[model samples]
Target: MPEFTMSEKIYREEVHFTGRVQGVGFRYATLQVAKEFEVTGEVKNLPDGRVYLCAEGAEREVVAFREELEDRMSPFIRESEIKSDFRPSSYKSFEITR
Candidate 1:
């Protein structure tokens, strides 16, 4: 039998989504998607007409969270920019920020 091992890296991602990403429940939708993953972070509407999402967790989990969120909100996202790191962040829960 093989045993599963969790990733030692705590990956963090800061994603900025553009095009129709605001004024359309983007933040709320992001919050809903975050609940489906182990990642903890926040999503908010940027003043420059973009949606900002910051998520951190196990490497795979964090990546999966971004993938799922992108898939779920593809229609509203015309483009996206992502910055990733193998660092840890403190976020007690996922949320939609003002």
Candidate 2:
């Protein structure tokens, strides 16, 4: 039997979602979705009425998590901007920041 190993590059994504993102359970819903994925970071409501999301994990997992989040929160998200880069993971768990 051939030995197999799995390795994936980890990355961090900073996403800003605007529109009815604040005051609509957006942060709570994001927290719930974060629990289902293997990513770590935080989500918070910005003063400018945008939801700021910072997540770091395996590239594939992070991407999937983002996609799921967008799908689940589509109704409240009118505009979204994403920026990604290779960053050392620094969070122990996902959280909602004030």
Candidate 3:
């Protein structure tokens, strides 16, 4: 039998969403998606009509989070700019940054 091993890399992504992001529950929706996949990080509204996210979790889970945001988030989302990186961090929970 073969044993399963988890990926050693921790995925982190910062998403910059444009168009009708604010005043439309964007942050709230992001929080839900992150929690669904057990991702840990922070999400906040940027001053430049965009949303920022710093997510840290298992590689697969983080990838899922990005997909969900683009595919299943609120209708307010028009376009998204995503930046992904691989690193290590200790994130216990997800949060909505102010």
In terms of lDDT, which candidate is strongest?
2
Q: What are the lDDT figures for the candidates, one per model? A: 0.85, 0.89, 0.80
Q: List TM-score per model, in order.
A: 0.87, 0.89, 0.81
For 1-98, candidate 3 gives per-residue lDDT tens digits of 44434465577887788888888888888898887896899889998888888888877888888788878764777887888877666567998989
Ranking by lDDT: 2, 1, 3
Q: Worst ten-residue run, lDDT, model 3?
A: 1-10
Give the top-scoring candidate (TM-score). Answer: 2
Model 2: CA > 4 A from native = 1-9
Error of 1 at 19 (Å): 0.7
Clashing pairs in 3: none
Judging by lDDT, tell me the better candidate of 1 and 3.
1
RMSD list, candidates in order: 6.3, 6.3, 6.0
- Candidate 1: C-alpha RMSD to true structure equals 6.3
